[model samples]
Target: MSLVRSAGLQKFRQSVEALGGDPEVYARRAGLPVDALDSDELLVEDSALAAVLEIAAADLGCPDLGLRVGRAQDFGMLGPLAVAIQHSPSVADALACTSRYMFVHARDLSVALVEDPDGSHGVVGLRYSFSAGKRPLPQATDMTMLFLHRAVEFLVGGRYGLRSVDLPHQPAAPRSRYEDAFGARVRFGRDAALLRVPSSLLSRPLDGVDETLRRLALAFLSQQSSEARPLVTAKVRTVLDQSLGTGSTELVDVARALAVHPRTLQRQLAAEGESFASVLDSVRRARARTYLTTTDMPLSQVSDLIGFAEQGVLSRCAQRWWGRTPSALRQEARSRARPRA
Candidate 1:
């Protein structure tokens, strides 16, 4: 499964309890261990993290749950990654560092600077996306978007040239909620989640950057990444997770992404006692469970998102995998998520 550091849930418990919902109850419903958020070093499934946020939002009657939690978090939650970023000489350097080492935080999440998304000059889009089977739930997107906004503010103080925020999905909460959280014009129903900023801001040097500290922090992160480098099976799982929704789940496409010959990739999986098809099924199963338990999405939509051509295919697979129909699985999940009096 695609995993992320528990730091993503920095204020999760407080946000849930503030809204009068039990964090533990919601965590359990989303297949996360109750203590998942207790340590930043701990790893949890990325989908589970997303699910817990969405579940808490729905159960606690808080439509702006992601924004609330995100507003309470700062760069410190990123731990060593924060230190390295803070010590970068320029905003562009920091963003490059973030893009490179973010995998140390969340394997499935990606962020980058894109030039002129709307074909405008001197503007850059800081885009956030998940390499998972499909786009994340709205609450997850909201949380990340707000966090990115806050991080830039921390780096440059109040002078950060944030123009607007773009969101992929339509408003899940009020437009004012997004505007208040971002402190900028917020546009919804966009192609990607982005933070628009003047490109010149990228070259502005940060105040009090310490080159020595930055190097040390980078060394620590480099060593950590080396130690945590996943096996071939794990790598294949990540590729499959992203490919499932795109109809390119074939082995050759995955091999191309990995820069390996198909035969070479097949042999490596064989050495790990796995096959490409098996890995794809595993990713689909995990995504299926997540979608069923955490979302009210229709069965047909869920099927399409998981790369099945028809709802009946999903139903049959669900029965084979879990001895229940997809509808039955969803009903059970809903029943279990209801709060006790």
Candidate 2:
């Protein structure tokens, strides 16, 4: 179950009002709580919010409604998540923090740093799904992509020099709305939504990053991490995500951190019809797929990030899993992610 952040909805309401539309009318008409967006802590159902956005847009006679909502969003709208990201050392650190702690915002909102092949360009792919195995509404998607871009602008000084915006669905709103807001080409009906950026931008230290705020936010996020969310399985996944890059995702190490015996952890996982090795493999596959498609990360780095000893190991795994070598997988992924005609 994924929960959406209330801030985006709040922006929708604001945008509606700014355009002389009645937000209350749309809220009531859409079967939503009129004040839901006003509450910062409230986590909303993405599906319901999507429906509301669609209805609100149509009711207001605004095709760029979602784009407006996104363009208006600021870092403060992200609440604590914004604090954490803003205070981080650099854009890369911010993205890592987001990936680690995003469960608090949305159950399945994923933000990642994807470097392009040969160290050319990199992108940050923002993928959000309210429910498992289901895509989110087009309005919601547009709002999120644009809002995140704005958030980046607030963090840095410029537009983050975005290369393009890759949207999964065809334009529900006007194409110019996206292009104007992004200041970049807008490609629709792609495989996923991403913000293409320069690889060099990831390391640029954010100006005026408050160390105190960053420390405080990190402490808060530690207590509220995904580990504390649902089950032991969730904790394991979180640990795996954090440890993969270090080449240390062993179950024993994980269980040791939890202060549990390896056997005890194994037994717990077995009760859920899973195993430590299985869980590790699952995490690896998920990370590998994201890296292969979203980034131009070299195969060697990808191998290291996913806990393979070397590049060939990752190649073997890819061959077994996707029936394609790493290069082929990357090619196929790029092809799929390309905008449709």
Question: Residue-wise lDDT of candidate 2 within 1-341, one digit each (tens)?
Answer: 45555565867767886776666556656654444555554445667777788888887788788888877766686677789898899988988888888777777677765543224435444444344557777888888888888777887887677777788899986788789988999898876677777766778999888989988888876776554443565567668878888746777899987889999999877754568887787678867876877689889999988878889999998988778898998897566556658
Clashing residue pairs found in predicted model 2: 115-296, 116-296, 117-296
**Over 4 Å off in model 2, which ranges?**
115-132, 227-341
TM-scores, all candidates, are 0.67, 0.62
Give the winner by lDDT. 1
* Model 1 score (lDDT): 0.84
lDDT per residue as tens, model 1, 1-341: 77787889988988887776768668878977554555565567888999999888887788899999999986898888899999999999999999988888887688899975787788899999888457888999999999998999899986487888899999889999899888889988888899999999999999999999999999988775524443676688778877778758888988999999999999988765578887787778778877887789999989998999999999999998889999998897677668868
Taken over the whole model, the C-alpha lDDT of each candidate is 0.84, 0.74
TM-score of 2: 0.62
Worst 10-residue lDDT window, candidate 1 = 224-233
